[model samples]
Target: MTSKNNPKAFPLNLPEGDAELLLDELQTRLREGRRLFAEVGQILAEIESRGVRDLYGYNSIAAFYEHVARVPRAEAQRVTGRALALNSRRARDGTTIDPVAPLTGESASTGALAEAGIDRIVTVMKRLPDHLDADERLEAEKGLVELAGVARPRDVTMAGTDLLARHDPDGKPKDDPEPKRQRSEFWLRQKRTGRWDMRGNLDPETGARLNALLVPRAYPAPGEVADDRAPAERRGDAFAEIVDLAEAGPDIPAPRQTAERVTEEPQPAQPSEEPASRPKPTQMPPQGRQSPYRGSGEGVQESAATERSRNVAHLRPPRWWARLSRPRSGNAAQPHKPLTA
Candidate 1:
């Protein structure tokens, strides 16, 4: 009986020798599949170049492959990409030279590399700078091919990465600062209960600045020598202090100016056959003498003292109320009159 790890164990229903034979056959088939995959890429590229899609009434080669060959859109793109990168063979004299992709395509045809290994190597090559001279690319490809012969796909990927880093220590195809800015964000969302959830991924510089400002405040105050606050509690307090300090800062912005309403020119009032008439306000009669103890409006008469007692008698009288209580000019000795509506 063969151990579970043995190749013979794969074809469980077969004897050891037969199972071993089947395993060998499967390995052979896998190699052939990879080689055929590479060839398919070449065919796909030719189809694209010839505008075969127009003849087939398909929008794109990928779409065609999606329907006809059942290949996914993404996988089709990958296959075509590999084809262009690996199958091209041309010299300055227009004569065909050896195909490129020494690591992936060449090795795949020879049954020395699997699809995963090929993919890894291809991915590494793709990430390399387009400005790389032919010689540099060839050397890199050669190194990866040699490594792939004995290493797993993951190891090949790592090896390729190391090679790339060594070749371009600063990292290739130099990135713009814009994408980093785009990746950074801060979010604050209000929950149904009126509380907020604050979350953010900040740039290194901003994060460092915030950390520097808050870290000191997060520690117990000098006066509270035996503080027992948890780290989170301390941090929360520190954050509150930071917010207060920010509020106190002079950099607080003035409120934004509202957009001015766009006023259209008023249309000239069309001359009317009859001019609009204005209504005159009714003239009010001069009040007869008002009693000092009674309010101006219609109501039961109450002495100023009595009114005050009903309200805030202990409070000093308002200036206007005091003036009203004092005898008016020319009415010093007038008898009090009952109020009327």
Candidate 2:
């Protein structure tokens, strides 16, 4: 069998054509290919119905297709699976069982939807809640099939997802009466090198709280240099800051104060048996001779010296009377004149 636009049928020196004509031919060929693929799926479904094991000595239709079609195992399995999903099944009694997504199957058979778009539609149909009635499932499938006709496969998938959400808003049913228990674990260890290692397996609630606290602190520091720290390092630094803040809080207790004890009492001061020696008086300079210690000033140094002598004279006991009372040794001691500067 050969196609009208088969490359093998054309000459090597075929003439070039207008760009628009070339594009039109390409689109036509692509549509023909899609139709042929749909036909292939139908044939595979018929082969499965007849019993592949008896016909080809293979355990499964996918295995038989892989060997006969010279295709990869995964690809063969995908095609066989899609074929089974889009085709109706016969019960033991020969009663017809409709395909999961009958509308989607119909669209796929006509080559109006791509295989991926058909798969998306079938998935949405299968995921619809069992509580939903047949009519609701049919309506959802119909909507997705229509969306798949005009949109790309990805857009079809999105539409199918939305359809499933609208039909089954609660998601999977919870049969158990008791709520699930949330579990969390944390471990911390200090290495010999003085660095700490921390690990945690937090439940949803605790993880959310930790994430909220760390996200703000983990942001790169604002400066000319970009922050080059790894994410784990940033989080570690943030945790250390949190510890410091907690330690400095007012709730932390103050350290205890200790008092020193005295071992013995102090003794009272006692007078010495011998009196303290008195300081000797300084000798005065001779009245006629100028003192060598004097500065350039004529009378300033003399006046200062005189003031010192006067102060010393007041301190001296009245020696003139004592001298008179004592006997005159060599000559009668002249009445001692009062000391003068």
Candidate 3:
């Protein structure tokens, strides 16, 4: 009776057929998932090996990200950093770790690709201090290998390297274009990147001085106004404005003209008659009133002679051959001694 009263309820378990079916399905799913994961791991590793060589040219973690891995340049950078950290750990302890294994969802952990990309970028930064910024260098290393997993890192780096090589410190490219001997301007195009470059042939000092003057004109001083004058008129006005600025600019002190003292010969006075319509001038410009540049125009010949002296000063024979180069100047200081027998 007690068994009959208990028997109204069945055992709280699945029917055997359904239980077996559920177990089979779970086992199948698990096996498939493992297979998929392992497959991904192997593929990523294959990509990384070749990719590293491609972008890095021979061997590099950055290439691994970009080439064999097929990670986009940006994402590859983020992943490369993680790979670097792992490699560093492997390096510190005598352990060898594979970068792609974790990145491809093969290992117990995933998403390390981002970290790997970033770490690789940091390592690359150390290598290319001259060219790349911190973030950009890291990006190059990090993304190269990962990008290779999907596509070819060679393509990515080829494009990137070619483009990057053209930049200078000012973010403009340092131009090494073919000389424009005929024309003043010339352009150079990089075959790999298809970038164009420009060059000019100004001497270094001249270029710097010209830049100093032109930079201000390009970015004019405050209180300057633009005029709708023709190009020639504008240029003339600009010259005049600059002259005025030199004469009385608040920022710069005006330079005084240097005077040359004159050695003069007294000349007999020659008088000229003033014509009927002529008027006397009240004032004259600095040059007309008391000239500093010309002096008295008296010792002009002497000045010319002094310049000649300076010119010949550069020529001299060795002291042992003294008599060979000496020139006779008929002055008491340079008195002629008799030629030695």
Candidate 4:
């Protein structure tokens, strides 16, 4: 008999024959695989109920699984955790507890839902508001299971989220009041190296405000070069900019002057007991004393000397000039000759 076509074809070598038969074989094998996975969850559940530590001497079921399954600790924990959520458990008093998502567990056991779909349902059930009555919770779980059977994992997630939104509109219990205790905390410490270590926990409102302030500043500068900073680094720089803005804001008051400075008023000038000392007059450099600029350049020295001489000439004519200008005792006045250095 010819089998229906499957959009999802298995990657495997098949005998040359009807494509429909191959597709049917693929589908059958896939369903069997899912059934085997469900059986594994059941087995893990039994192992956990019996206590893996008591049976295998391992500290935890996840550790035991990691050793025997040859998987990473994280992966082992995830698998065992998922399995535990999907299977019924026994209380310390010997009472049997229902699986978190009863309908999902049943569907999974029957191979009607894949692992992904099962996880989605379990997550939704866990997040349901405590206000939901037992019957209402079961009904919600049932709806999700039905959806999981027909839809992809992502679609299942979306449906479950919508269902939760309807029940927990405010994202918390309707009957709970706002907490009185402060929920936010911050810590800052500077190391000997001058680098700062900052960490904190912020309540939802504070976190939202902080996010709004940093997001705009965290964007990479507009330029040809790509910003290679890690997201955390960019956020750090944004925080520093915020601090600077706060410090420079007009509303911030200027720092007060120190008391020492304010108290030290200029002392009033006291009447001098003795006559005020006469101001010392500047004396000319001694003759033949080299100018400080002599080694720098002749032009510098000459310019400085010429400037000094001009000042001197302005005050009174030089001796050489006066002697030259004075007529010889018996000679008539001769044309004044230019003075030479």
Candidate 5:
């Protein structure tokens, strides 16, 4: 009898080694399943099933590869093509098609499948048919979103969305200018297509030089500080200024002027008006019966003093009772009548 702790002369290498061996034997003995052959058979079959004809694109083949064979859509495409190519080469006398390579070709690591996976995906995204149903769009968009995982879609293409967003009102990402990159502010805007519309961002030195070249022409000399303009406006104005400067180079001759052009165009001045001729006459109606104040000197003095007294009484403040009165509470204020002279 073996010692209690002694290892077996022919011990199983690992706990699962027997299981792995069993699985290998089982795989070797098993006949290929109908399901595996079914999908492949359908691909070769001349007659399309009810909706199978609808699925004519390589995409359907891809989906079949993914769902049935447990491979990615991209790998499935490559494998399917390889399988077809291999099948095409054999004598046409009803020879059995090679099945193993097509399925197993996908066994290679996914990282090795395509040099420019992101690029191909972006191309597909751009070309997605606008007429596709909403469901189809969602499915296609899902694939695109996945592609953007490895590389940002915006980096790959910017023309459509970027251009439209700049010109179209609603397409702009926000009312404010797009966020600037940290290294140096470059112009960037989002497109409807979800790619970045990037104009070159100058380095700090280049930006300063460009700005210095642009400022006087684009922005009037007022403000005189870089901080005054919004980055968007500054960029826009700067572009306009650059075009103008390049178009109107330093050596271009100044616009010529003529005396005719310079002469302040004068209009005939308006004529002055003449004073009108008029007649003069004077008459008086005796006020208050040719007052005694005017006729006799002593009476005149007395009369003037009486009038002064009346005028002083009229000009004085409110009467005794009136002086003590105030308005009732909460009355709406009203305008007062003018005092009689």
Candidate 6:
């Protein structure tokens, strides 16, 4: 088309007109790029069908695109994947036929769909369960593609997600938030100062599981009176109990035994020339000797003992050490004098 007739050409010396014209040109270029991108999928499909190594001496079609065409491996792979979905083909048995992405393929080639839109439609279509018959799959693909042609990519993705959920609502992922198998992390380390610092993140379900185990144990027992422990202290006690339970359980690993140093066994010692001397047993004291201060006669202690007892017996308290040790209770009671050290 001539420059004056071409709607894409921006007119010089007209700033407002140029802005509008530039925008239109950009939009047109984008549509044209999308159309060409869709066509490239077809070419990639043909390249994939024929062994790339045999035809072009490249190990794979992706290698050919990366090395020769300068296309990134990821983009090349995406193109090949989309192409396989678009192009209808017979299986190795030649009896079963693959369903072609009719709605997506046509819309993409006609520039009705952008890259994101096409991706959304393809994702929804592929996510449909295999148990669904061909008619069901076709209907889903048609609905998604129609949405993609008009809607923004974000809206298209949301719609795709909803469609997948509707089709197989009962089906769950392989790792569907199971408490036991789900990933969780915990880190507890003792610092040099003997204080423990713990930090970790856990999935919501995992956190719930931990709360279930700890909350009940942290609270005081029924009918108990003194339950004024702080929250942190209770949690600490609960954690200690958990560790005790773990140690008591059979699953805990045995402590590692340290290796002993290797050395030659000691030789037996020879017998001494002379026999060892035996200790002599003590003889009983003379039965005739009377015990000291026993009032059995022959011991000189009765006079001094009687004199010493008479001196200190009056100083003893009524309750022995009660005056020195007993706590003062009522107003009527006398204060106890402090005892000398």
Best by lDDT: 4
What's the CA error at residue 174 for candidate 5, in Å? 50
- lDDT (tens digit, per residue) of candidate 3 on 243-298: 43343333443222223112333345445774533222222122211112222442
- Residues 12-51 of candidate 5 have per-residue lDDT tens digits of 3444558778676554433234234333534533222222
Worst 10 residues of 2 by lDDT: 255-264
List runs of model 3 lying over 4 Å from the truth.
1-60, 86-240, 243-341
Residue 134 alpha-carbon offset, candidate 6, angstroms:
2.0
Supply the TM-score for candidate 2.
0.45
lDDT score, candidate 1, position 1: 80
Q: Which residue pairs does candidate 1 place in steric collision?
A: none
- How many clashing pairs in candidate 5? 5
- lDDT of candidate 5 at residue 196, scale 0 to 100: 42
Q: What are the lDDT figures for the candidates, one per model? A: 0.63, 0.68, 0.42, 0.72, 0.42, 0.64
TM-score of each: 0.45, 0.45, 0.23, 0.47, 0.25, 0.44
Which ten-residue region of model 4 has the weakest summed lDDT?
Answer: 286-295
Ranking by lDDT: 4, 2, 6, 1, 5, 3
Cα error of candidate 5 at position 243, Å: 3.9
Each candidate: how many clashes?
0, 0, 54, 0, 5, 0
How does candidate 5 score on lDDT? 0.42
Which model is ahead, 1 or 2, in terms of lDDT?
2
Candidate 1 residue lDDT tens string, 1-341? 85677444444354556767788878778778877776777777567666654568787767777777887888876666666666654443556544447546666656677667777888888777777888998889888888887888889989988987877777745556564334667876656564456789988889999999879867764442566677776776667556544533445443332332123333455468866542222233222222122124323322332343333322322232333355767998994442221
Candidate 2: tens digits of C-alpha lDDT, residues 1-341: 76677456344333576677667777677667777887788788777777787777899889988998899999999888888788886644677767787777777766677888877877777788888888887787787888888888899878877777786787887687787776898887656564555688999988998888878766775657677777776776666545444443445443322231132243444468757343344554432222232135624644554554444433333332343355555756674333221
For residue 209, give model 3's deviation from the true position in Å: 20
The reply for model 1, stretches above 4 Å from the true place, is 1-20, 89-103, 173-341
